[model samples]
Target: MKIPIQLNQENLQEVGSRMPIPDYNREADNTGIVHIGVGGFHRAHQAYYLHQLRQLGEALDWGICGIGLREADAKLQDIFNKQDHLYTLMVKHSDGKIEPEVIGSIVDFKMGTKDPEPVIAQMAHANTRMVSLTITEGGYNFNPTTGEFNFDNPDIQHELKHPQDPKTVYGFLTAALKRRREAGLPAFTILVCDNIEHNGDMMRKMLGTFAEAQDPDLAKWIAQEVSFPNSMVDRITPVTTQTDIETLAQKYGVKDSWPVTCEPFIQWVIEDKFSNGRPDFEKVGVQFVPDVGPYEKMKLRLLNAGHSVLGLLGALHGHPTINACIEDEVFKNYLRAFLDKEATPILGNIEGIDLTDYKDSLLERFANPNIKDSVSRICAESSAKLPKFLIATIHENLAIGGSIKFATLVIAAWCYYSDKEADQNGQAVEIIDAMSTDLHQAAEQTKTDPLAFIRQESIFGNLIRNERFTKLYSEVVHKMYKDPNIKKYMRDMISIE
Candidate 1:
């Protein structure tokens, strides 16, 4: 099929597609939100919602100005620049239906490598009342053990010393807020859209730690002025591929260089706290609440943690994508047992949320054949992800004397996957973690002594000292190693009959 028109601000009125395009005036829209980490999730979710409001003529000022920090971001900067900051979002439903929309919320963007000065200037600009972030779970740079900002990190140390010539995000935020202070400008509300549990509070601590290292006075000013509202954002956006772009052009009649494909479902639950007033996101189905704690915990324990379980086990079983994992009975049954027997016991109640229904919804989402969500993507950054997603459930289960059968399996499955060059079906399993070198080395050491992996003090932190956990983990790892094939062993171990 021939492409109808190139997706751009100039071609929206002329483009023919099954879905909608922004009819709002782009030139008249002013930038109100400077989003750090312009990636797939931010574009598909928050940016999509903002575009909704923009189309309604309600959010003319909340147009997004995206900022890309890393060197690789230059690719995206060029992609957006060529398209006039308009990209297509193709929503894939579970039933195999596709809905494509052209989003025009991102009015401007700055590449940090090209000119860091403009990013700071726009961030400090009076129109920029809020700074939102989707920089992934690990980008916050907190010490895993200490639960504080890792000021001792070499990059952070450099930023602390030279605040003006900043590199780390903390430094940029610190410098921008300082400028706001001197100029008597009201500090922007810091909205954290990451997956960290108690995200707002954790962000406050991290940013506050950065500020304190710079100047005690500035630290105090930030603590008093800025509002870091905790938020729960849920969407399964797979990494974009060139194939996705080609398919969009072929099937949807739109030619997009870099388009984001996401599931039809999307949800954002935010705490009602903003230093500077926020946009009318509630109009677009954003849940504004008095407290985001319950919602945060629910999503973390069930969705994020559940993803980790499926991710590690799926990889070990030689499944490539999440839907592939869902297709297997052994994995799906084990996941349900983990949720019902282990995770749900420790979970506290969230107001108006039906836990059972939520769990069912997760199963449906995970089983969505259209999403094409990769197990490898979910398995990436295991060092950061496992601690956030799985460790909490382990600690809680162990403390309460709940059966850790599933937690043990979760860790054991990861160990089993890491200890091999390829998964059970001879599919290559890449260990992708920032700490992969050290973690893989430790995993290799565990071949001799099962305790080597758990002995990483920064990650385990005295958890190995627990007699029950240690015994169970050792037994699980030893059993996993003794078995010649992982699939047969997992069948018996998880009781997958």
Candidate 2:
């Protein structure tokens, strides 16, 4: 057995010649970007891009200082402290190739679970020119139905009352911006890297509204001075399991407390707008476009929505991973039908993007055998995901008199998945959603009231009132109840479409 090399700055030389290690002087680099919600996707995507830039011996000033906002982030803080803020990124190719590299872009980390003062100070620091976030779809703290910031949230209220002891993302951001303005420094660009539609616009509106409530002058200044650039980020980074850690140690002989694993595919499209000067990300395959709307819409509707299409239905069919689901012909065909028939027609015309080739590439990415992206991971936040991914597609299709059959089936599958909380094989499937209780209750009501699931105004929202949608939805739900052969149903639906 090869001896394991503990990953840290002092042991960089020991890990040499096995996988590529950072050759740059990490200590000399400045933290030009401060990223919140330093999760797997963030590490695998943005941080990896910066690492690639640094590997080319450029963008040394654009090092990252990562901050974790929740109590769970303390685990990351511990790992980063032990590893000297260094970790391995093991990229798994479709053909069973594993390429590992030590990424040194995340030079420092701060945990803001207990006290927000240090995080705020770091963001307010003069060297920090950009504040990026991957706080997930729900972290924006907006009402899904109204599309407005939720000021009544306890954390938001606390931040409003006690700005000095802020906790939420908005709280820390607002405090840091206030400090920067008072110090006569320019505002940093707010780059939101979440999967939301028009992410930059959403961030500006939410933050500006919050700032306005606190101090109107500060809100006005933020609107005038700060630049919120919309971006579309894509990469399939699965949750790192214990087996992944063991594989890294046993196969690669590198002992890392926490390392990220992902597919070789990655893409980021950002609007060419920044308040302070930005990094030359364009040098490293990052697309800086004028309007990210077309790209953003295409992704949200097809790639993201396609995930939900497979996730909800796949889970019910007893599939464990995304690749497993996509490998099955029925599931794959269903996804293709949803993309080609339902999603593509509404996308209008996206310049520089072939919808056919893009959809085909999505299938190839999902079928990557080495990436064990769990169905549970994809189905975790249905309440937050459906609105942007699948539900919006259904809404638009209804408006344009297009097909909602595929999307309607997915909703029916979600209801069954939520109600039974078990697969067709009688194995218990975990339900993870903020609206789990309500979802389960509403789903359970489908036994008597077939319309109960769609009646949730916050989620389905008037879709139940549409005659065509309600009729289609009711038929699908009843069919699921009477016969739970999801694969057969999917095949039949494909034939119908």
Candidate 3:
């Protein structure tokens, strides 16, 4: 079985359709599992898992139908049509090995807003047993500080008015659940696969808030019937570039028009509660836990927290790649100290987890040179990320009177990164966020009041009101602001010698 040299649509299908010697599609019967925000991560992780289950005969009756929220429909529509809803997944490793796999989890695609009538009606179908989402942390439109629904968002307002014609993810879920309640249908599980602390609980809160706002009857129905399952999903699927396309065609010898590349390592920890039913994912590599809290917290506090700390710091210091950042003596040492000295104390001991081994493997993953993932790319939406990565750890650490000095360094790095005018070589860097302008404005006010700069009610919520964090953060900010060379300051502060 020789591999192809170019992976375009035609060559990919010709090869993909024949590989693994199994036809999972034949066993599938469109058991309704609507997936929202079908981006690269979903395609790489969750969809890949389901495709494997179908191949193993457990998910034979469960096929995925992808729905695009907001303006995501056009781009995904083009990709689905180009490749017949079949795409190539290249699993790349630090060892310079590449495994090209054909993923067949998605059978149909619809831009719900483009054709809202049929898509909304489809949710009412009896076979539709679940609704899974990877709408990102920001897509939920929940305030990061308070972790409550942001009803003030205009899009949310639109959805509230026309619940059936949902303009937001919460609106869609709430409206669909209402339909199920009216029909006396069992509520399907609402699975949230994002990098948030207690993803299930957070999602449930948003849905609960939305439901409460809509009507009391609908709210009570959702509370009793629906189960929001928490999950920990991990994979590094960088945004695809044209260079990736060229490499896929030249290196893999298959023509995959929209191929998704990711690291070989993947993890998914899920709660085993399903309202209607779920595939037996145990045969694959998924961990079914009694409570997903500990696992979720560990990932969020360590890997996710580490990513933001090094990511923004790396960006601020002009390191382009995450590997390069980890390789830098200053940044790498800062990260090692932060994770071990700061985060470990707060994370404490979780069952089956060794903090030292976890940090070692995480560092290795971050140092994979072949994975040219940029800090800027991963550092997008810091407003949503900080709560999960930094603030949550800060909260726990504060409870025990543990020092948040390292956490303060990470926060300072974020403020500086947001204020930088150019990249390492002085190339202009684009700040990507709805909150960027506001962050910039806040950064400008730092000279007058360091505490004011740190007090983004949107990012930290009222967590800054804590006298301890405010006191500690004020010290870090004043020092970083005065020194004007934070990289050197970090190097000196974490000096081993």
* Best-performing candidate as measured by lDDT: 2
lDDT of 2 by residue, 1-497 (tens): 66789999999988875789988868724899999999999999999999988889898788999999999999999999999999999999899899999999999999888878889999999999999999989899998778988988998998888887888888898899999999999999999999999999999999989998887888988999999999999999999989889988999889998999999989999999999998888889999999999999999999999999999999999999999988999999999999998999889998899889999999999999999899999999899999999998899999999999999999999999999999877789999998999999999999999999989887877798899999999999999999888998898988876
Please provide TM-scores, in order, for all candidate models, with all chains considered together. Answer: 0.97, 0.98, 0.93
In order of TM-score, best first, we have 2, 1, 3
Clash pairs for candidate 1: none
For model 1, the stretches where C-alpha displacement exceeds 4 angstroms are 16-18, 493-497
Give per-residue lDDT, candidate 2, residue 287: 98
Clashes of 1: 0
**Superposed model 2: Cα runs more than 4 Å off:** none
lDDT score for residue 194 of model 2: 95
Backbone clashes for every candidate come to 0, 0, 13
RMSD of candidates 1 onward, in order:
1.6, 1.0, 2.6
Candidate 1 residue lDDT tens string, 329-421: 877877888888888888877789999999999999999998979989999988887777788788888889987778777787777676674
lDDT for 77 (candidate 2): 93
Which of the predicted structures, 2 or 3, would earn the higher lDDT when compared with the native?
Answer: 2
lDDT value, residue 324 of candidate 3: 93
